[model samples]
Target: MFYTYILASQRNGTLYTGSTDDLAKRVFEHKEKARAGFTAKYGVDKLVWFEAFEERENAFRRERRIKEWRRAWKLRLIEETNTDWRDLYDDLNNLLSY
Candidate 1:
């Protein structure tokens, strides 16, 4: 599966939107600051939201759309799905069972 995900530094904080074939691995890398870029520099590594897709194309498209949205719109999207804005990364282990 593919996924479109959002990572935030905190509730309504620095936000990032991206698509990946492996959500768990990508979020883990961000949390670890494995690469030197926006996520690391801005400390936006808390997985806040994600949606799975059957195809990569759809995931990428959704990611692009989300990225283009205004900050308020994006915040609403996140709040609608994750009202508490929890760090979804903490739940990844249970989701993956690995």
Candidate 2:
């Protein structure tokens, strides 16, 4: 499986759009600031929204598209499913553990 995910510094804060085959590990890295990049520098480590895809291309495409979207559009997209902008990383890990 692949995933397109959005990470936010906080509710209505800095946001990041990315795609990865391993969603849990990638998000964990962002949270831990494991790499020196936009996510770590901007402190955008809260998993606010995500979508899974059977194909890596699809996930990558969705991530690219979302990255091009306006901030308002991105915020709306996140709010659509995560109105309160809760961190979803823990939930993702729980699901994987099961």
Candidate 3:
């Protein structure tokens, strides 16, 4: 599986969008500051939102679409599902144990 994900610094701060095949590992790397890029530099490690895709092309396209959206649009998207903008990493971790 592949995933398109959004990370945020805060409710109204910077946002980072990307796609990866290993969503859990990618998010973990970001949380650990393992990669030197936008997420690490901007401190956008909070996994605010994500969607899985069956194909790499679909994930990439969704990520690109999100990247081009306005901040308000992105906020609305997250708010729709995650009004609190909770760190989804913890939720994912719990789900994996089952």
Give Cα-based local distance difference scores for all models: 0.91, 0.93, 0.90
* Local error of candidate 1 at residue 4 (angstroms): 0.2
Flag regions of model 3 displaced more than 4 Å.
94-98
RMSD of each: 1.9, 1.6, 1.7
Give the clash count for each candidate: 0, 0, 0
How would you encode candidate 3's per-residue C-alpha lDDT over 1-98 as one tens digit per residue? 88999999988788999999998999999999998998889899999898888899999999999889988999999999999988889889675444
What's the TM-score of each model vs. the native? 0.93, 0.93, 0.92
Q: Local error of candidate 3 at 25, Å?
A: 0.4
lDDT of 1 by residue, 32-57 (tens): 99999999999999888888888999
Model 2 spans > 4 angstroms off: 94-98
Q: What is the lDDT, from 0 to 100, of the residue 87 in candidate 1?
A: 93
Q: How high is the lDDT of residue 6 in model 3?
A: 92
lDDT string, candidate 2, 53-91, tens digits: 989999999999999999999999999998988898878
